[model samples]
Structure formats: C-alpha cells, structure tokens
Target: MSNTMRILGAPNLYLQGPGAIERIADIVANLGKCALLVADPTVERMLTPQLTKLLTSVGVAFASAPLVGEVTPANVARLAGDHRADVVIAAGGGKGIDAGKAVSRAMSARLVTLPTAASNDGPTSRIFIFYDDDHKLLSAERVPRNPDAVIVDTQILAGAPRHLLVSGIGDALVKRYEAAQCVGAGRPNMFGGRATLAAVSLANVCEQVLREHAVDALAVAGSGKPDESFEKVIEACILLAGLGFEGSGLSIAHAMTRGLSALPATAEALHGRQVAYALLVQFVLENRSAAFMADQFAFYAAVGLPTSLAELGLPKPSADDLRTISSLTHKAPHTRNFERPLSEDELTEAMLQLEQMRQHSAG
Candidate 1:
C-alpha cells in the first residue's frame, strides 16, 4: 500500500443478535471443518455445551481449550500445543478472544471471535493485545487479516454484568474525537495508511449511537432480554468502534491506557473504564471548553463511568504515582497522534486539571 492510501480492515462476516450464536456452525463450516474452541471458564460453563452441540450437528470436529489467566505468550503457546485445527473459535471476553487470536496465529489457522460481552472493541480488528503474567500491557500482535467472523450474541451480552456493557459504552464513546485528532494530525491508522472517510463516518455514528441509546440500553441490560436500544449500543461498542479505531487510529484516550495499566491503584480496573477516564485526560489536553467537559462529565456520571481519580479507585495519587503515569503516557506513540507533541509535564498538568474540573462538575 502507498503512504497516502486509505485503509479499512474488518471481519469478512459480522453477526449479532439474540440467536447469533446459533449461526456459528454454519459460519465455522464455511471457514473450516476442524475447529479449536478457546473459551474462558464462565463461557465454557454457560455456552460451551450448546456451541459444541451446534458444531457437532454440523459434523465439525472440535477440541476445547479452556483459557484461564492472562493472554501471555506462554499461556497462548500452552493452549496451542498439539491442538491443530483449521479454524479457532474464541468465545468470551476480550482476554479469551485475544488468547484465541494468539492460538490461531501460532497454529497458522483462521480465527473467529464470539464475544459474550460488549466490553471493548477487540473483536473485529486484526490486532490482538496480550499481556504479561503480571497483567502489564505487553506486545500488540497483528494477524495477517481481521477475523474471518465476529459473532456477537446480544442475548448473551445483555446477560453480562451491567457494568461491562457500561464499560463498552465508555470505550466506544471516544472514537469520534480520537479519530478526528488522528486524522487532523496526519497520523496513520493502525494499518499504516490514511484514515478512510468510512472510518471517520463510522466513528461519528458510533458516538451518536452511544449518546442516543446508552442510557436506555443500560436500563434493560442484564435482564437476559436485549431491547432494540441494547442491540444498537452493542453494535456501536463492538463493530463500529472496532472498525473506527483500527481504520482511523487512536490518540490520547487510548494512550492513557498504557499509564493506567502500569499503576497498581488503577491497574485492576476494566479496560473500558480505564479508557473512559483517559478520555477525560484527553479532553483536558485538548483544552476543551468548560461546557463540553461538563457535559461529558455528566454523561459519564449517568453511564456509571469514572470521572475522577477517586472514582478510578485512586483517591489521592502521590507525586510518584502521577510521575509514573505521565512518564508512561508520554512514552506511548499514540500520544503524539494529537495535534501537537505532548510533554510529560503537559500530561501531568492535564491530569491535575481534569481532577479539578471533575470535582467542580461533581459539585
């Protein structure tokens, strides 16, 4: 691809809805005959039987690889050991799905992601983020292409912990501003090409869908029945956000994840929640208008997303903590995807300013 070329990568087939899982056999059968199923423990207990039954009915031989712990290289290697398959079906949350991706890559097999929760946008994209045994952010590896199929069963998603769906909303909401920042700064997308018009448009629509339906969707989530609003939000969180970030690139909102993961106080928080808080720092760095910041804070409060260091479970961060976060954040390449290069001092100031603004907004 040329330097100026625009790129957009996505799953060849994307499926979502109440019974989307039912279509897995047909989808898998099209891709391969032998399948390796990688699932987290919860998904294994909840959905594996039904999935195996579906695949068995279609005469697709399969083996189960139960994923426990982080998606470390060692863990992925252990999971992939002697379990050859034509395709790997990864089912569950981001870690399990990412593990499946790594396993497929190790075995040189195709990958299909079945996300049980709309927690983040790791499903449709080719990139899979794996961490160390300590849960620190590790290398982000990319497959030759995006997933062959991305199956999102909305009923299963609706049954996920309500906070996870809210976290999805938090994660999806930042695509608009982040994409604009990346494009404005002439940064390459994750694919190392210019952001496509389609990506920018989808990023806008993803934010709009969240703004319109997130509250209503949260109201009905975990009822074990997904409403229309719930479905739209899931699509925004999983597909739109996935495509947007991969095709248009990321900026400060995502860069903050690096720092957040490094800190002990905030490291255990969910990815979407960490990103949501990081978006606030991005707003501060951009010098967003007071009204805009306030509106965002209000939206975050409504959606159960964190708005302050305290809310992120770090009420009183020490100077050393602040330094660690700023230093780590400044080192991230995406931090430069903004309109201007950011200094560690600038990051620290922005975070402190965000805390002040969050306090004022809360009052």
Candidate 2:
C-alpha cells in the first residue's frame, strides 16, 4: 500500500521445520558445485555427518570455514580470497550466519542460510553484524546480496538449547512495535533504506502470531507437541520477522540493542537476549499506557525472556558505560528514527530502571 517505499528480500525460497536441510539439494540444484559450508567447530561437528551425507548424495562440491568468534571485515576478506567454494551455506546460530553472509558478500557467491537454532532473526536478513576480535561491536554491514534461500530444520532447532528458543520468541515480539512506529511516522526503510508496505505487513503478522502462539509454541519447542501456537511463533520469528526487518525497516528496539552491545556484559549475551531486554526500554521510552507495556512484560515472562537489565546480565552499567553507549549510538544510521530521541542520561536511566524492575520483581 505504501507505493512510496521499496520492498526487497531473499530472491528464491525459504523452508522451515525438521528435515528442511535435507531438501537443500532441490533448493540450489544448479547454482554451483563447490559449496562452502561456514560454521563454528561445535556446530560443524554436530552437523557435519548430516551435511556431508546430503552434499555427497547430491554430488555437490564442498569446502569449509571453521568459525571462531566475532566475525569481522577481515574474516570476510579472508573467505573471499581463499575459498574453493562457488556457493556459500551458512549454518548454525546467528554468529555463524553472520560470518557466512560476510563470505558470500565478499565472494559475490550465492548464499543459503540454514539455521540450527531459532535464537535470533539474523538468519534471514541482508545485514551482518561485525565485531572485533574481543567481540566488541564494530558495525553492521549490508550484504551485497540477500540470501538465496533460508533452510530451517526443526530437528536441528529442536536440539538447540531451550534458552535460545525462548530468546527467539523475545526477538519475535518486537516486529509489530517496530513496524507500527515506522509506519506511524510515515517513514519507510528497508535493508539499508528500501522499506515497503509488504514488509511492514510481514512484520505485523509475525508479531501478532508470536503473541498468540508464543506460550504454546515454546512449550512444543520445549517439548515435542505439534502445537499450532509453536508453529506460528517459529514461522514468525524465522520467516516473517526476518523479512520484515530486512525488507521493511528497523528502528529503536534494534538501535538500542546495537548501542547496548558496547557494554561488555551485554555484548556477551545472545542477540535475541539483548533485543528482548531493549524492547522493554523501548516500551518505557514510548510511554505506552500501563496496560500495553504490562502486556509486553507479561509476554516476556510467559516465554521466560529477560525483560530487565539484570536478567540480561548488565544490572549495573556504570555511567561511563552509559556514556560509551550513547557515543556509539549518536551517529548510528538507525538512531534518527527513535520516537523518543535518546540521550546518555536517558539511556542511563533506562538501564537503571531495568535493574529496578528486576529487583522489584525478585522481591
């Protein structure tokens, strides 16, 4: 409906659920022969048997990149120069996915993302978060190309830690709020400024479904029931949320997250974990009616997500830390759109307020 905006996303297909990776052969049948598989050692070990079996069965050529930590521009530069692979397959959690996207972007190769954990929405996006060797935030760079396909295997996901699944639920919750704010201001941006109405709708639908199904789906994801609620939440988090953020736009919830990562304690947490905590800050900044904010708080509680800074492992971000965060955010491309422009004092207050919420809830 927003003709003034532009919509963009993955070009080919996205598959979800268990055994989805088994179908990778069909998804990238003829694009290339030598495929580069990118993941950390732990994930490589966990997925190698199945991945190798599948690739061999399909007669696909292969190479490998053993991921360490904090994928940087240097890593991308490395992969581009030495890979024998003509295609790139990013597997594992968000970190591995970011690394793989970097390789694909650097090499100008076709990329396919197969997420083993439902921890964050990064798997389907066009931007990859760059970090320093110490895992410090550097910047988030846009891939020259979005993924060709997204392959989600539920069995792989089912095997991931329960904490990650819950984190995914938390990240999924922000879709509606992010989209609504962007639309309300008549502002549109997509992956690097190509926002679209379809993308907004995509995010909206994901948010609603996550709200309705999060509890039940998390139960099923935790247990193994084919809960309708679980399905919707999973789809929204992995599919719609990815499309929405990348194709439509991102605002404060994520902007706040990027800023928070400057603090060492927060950076060590999972991306979804950080985002979930920031969502609470966003709610407070917006000054939503108590009823609305409470509903969101309840959602995080229902999914066992961290809604407070303490829960996110940063109960006491020092004034220096707060100032550092503000400095990082001051010129961040995404900072301009915040409904409430943030200052260091405000961010510091939000951080302390989060600590108070945790203490209040605990006592």
Candidate 3:
C-alpha cells in the first residue's frame, strides 16, 4: 500500500509583541517542561530577561544558547547537542529563529519561533538556512516540524527598527509575482515540493495587504502606535508574509534574492532588503511593465525601503561578475518556475537595467 497520509502538527506555538514576552510562561507551561531558549547576544539582552522570567514564573526548566554567528553546521551541531532541549524557544530576528529551527530539528524536539522583528517569513517557516564552516550558505534545510504555535503581539513587533519593518514589507510584496514565476518555472519549494492551492491564495492576500496598507502600517511601526492600521500592517508582516511564502513556494524573486545574497556586496543587506531588490530585477527580466512595478517602487519608497542600488548600499556588479553569477543562478532550486530560462547574458543585462532604473528614478 502506498503510504498516503500527511497532517503534521506543531508541538508548540509562537508568541510575539512587546508584552507578549511576558506571556511565555502561559504558553510554554501548557506545552512542555524543559525548554531551551535560543537567541543572539544582542537579542538575548533585549528579550531574554523577560523570557527567562516568564519561564521561571511557570516553573519550566530552561537553558539558553545566544547564537553569536551564522547558523553554520558547526553552530547547529554545537547548539543542538549542547542544549539538548525538550522544547525550543527561538527569539529575536530571522537568524535566531532559523537557528532555533535547526536546533529543534537536530535534537528531535518541539520548536517555537518568536520574532522581535518582523524582518522576514522565517519565523513561521519549517526550513532553516544552512551554512558552511566559513559562514557561506550551503542551502536551506527542510525540517520535519513546523512550530506548533506562532505568537505575535503587535506591541513587540512595532518596537523593532522601522527599517526592519520596511524590509518585511519588501519581502512580502514580491510573493505574488514570485508565485507566478514559480508556477511558470515548475520549481519546487524549500520542501522540494509543489505549491498548494492554499499557498497561492495566501500569497495573493499578502500582496493585497501590502499594496493597501504598507505605508500606513510602516508609519505605525515607526510611530509607537498600535492603532487599527498599525495592527493590520503587523498582521500582514507576520501572518501574511509568514504563511504565504511557506505555503505558496518561492519563485524567481526569492531565488534571485538567495542568489544575490551569495554575492559579497549584498551579503550585509537585510533579508527583506535583498528581497526588495530582487523584485526589481525580476520586473526587468520578465519584461513586466514598468508602470506595474512603479507602484511597487512607490510603496517601498513610502515605507523607506531603498528603491535603488545606492539605497541598498552597493556598487554595480562588474559585467564579468554579473555574467558569472547569472549563470550560476539557473541552478537555484527555486528558479524553475520562471517563464524563461535565464542566461548569463540575460542576467547581466537585468542588473544593468536595474541600475538604469535606479539612476532614472533618482534623477
């Protein structure tokens, strides 16, 4: 008989927000006992005390792994083996959440991802970034478990740097187009699987919210207000971006971002920042109407996301580098959904076109 059954369940839930950290006790005590909390030093200092206090209040056994660097294999091995946690609580930004996902999977424990910053969709994802010893990415690792719970309290998310919130909006806005590309290219997602109908619908919702409330939401995030508009944007950043990308599967936009991130110049840009630029490149490569993409630029500009190369803090790639990287991008696991196969020359041209758009827009 063909084994035909798939209904995975999250062992714990994620909780987000300012005072949301204080609720850790209520959420975790009900889930399990011994817990391992993973975060970076800075994030730890910012969010850990509250987490610790909450855990202490609930009488849950716990430990901490303040991840100091990228989630290299060594990092994962060290963390997963060292903590040996029964349940995992990942706090802070995307990196911390991805690292915690790795730790939870490796150690055969339940995971909960808490994001202090709405920087990307990694918080609600089951995939984690993998890296080589030198901190270069290997690829994404697909884990068996999705976090049992995802907790987002608008209060905590709004307090993050406005730039992080802008990046989140950038990351979210590109999903609709990326989903189309993925479908066109026949590319599999992080799971090496196809996109589901549920995923596609989620992506559309994300795009609609982005087009509608991104600026208002971002303003609220920056302004210390949790009004209806602010709450809407936070919801879009978390639930919409989170559920959309994971469910819909990425296409050229994200694939392009992954490829761009491999470049040294773009390596330092935030995930959402990189994703925003990738969307620009896609508009060029796919022959998408500038008028259509112009709205995207407007939305990003309104939110303070860098709409140009100068804003992204990078120089133009040399023709040689662009050509070489473009050739390599074809091999990306997510590129198959693109409408046309990209060549080195085409990729190089796309970069040049983006440069021109940036220059034209700036002037």
Best by TM-score: 1
User: lDDT of all the models against the reference?
Assistant: 0.89, 0.75, 0.73
Tens-place lDDT per residue, model 2, 244-362, is: 87776666677776677877787788778877777777676677666776676777788898877667677766778777766665656655656656676776676666566556655
True-vs-predicted CA distance for residue 76, candidate 3, Å:
1.6
TM-scores, in order shown? 0.98, 0.91, 0.90
- Which residue pairs in model 1 clash with each other? none
Overall local distance difference test of candidate 1: 0.89
Model 3 ranges off by over 4 Å? 1-18, 132-135, 185-194, 222-224
lDDT of 3 at 353: 84
Model 2, C-alpha of 139: deviation from truth (Å): 1.3
- Can you rank all candidates by TM-score, best first? 1, 2, 3
Model 2 off-target regions past 4 Å?
1-3, 192-194, 222-227, 353-363
Worst window of 10 by summed lDDT in candidate 3: 1-10
Residue 149, candidate 3: alpha-carbon lDDT: 70
lDDT of 1 at 300: 88
By lDDT, the candidates rank as 1, 2, 3
lDDT tens digits by residue: candidate 3, 1-363? 122221222224555455665666777777788888888888877766777777877789878889977888888888887766678888778888888888888888777777878888777778778866545568878668678777776777777788888888888878877877765566554444566676677778888887778777766675555667766666677776666676556766677655666666766788788778877887888886778767767767777776655566666666665655576566776666678777667766887887787677768
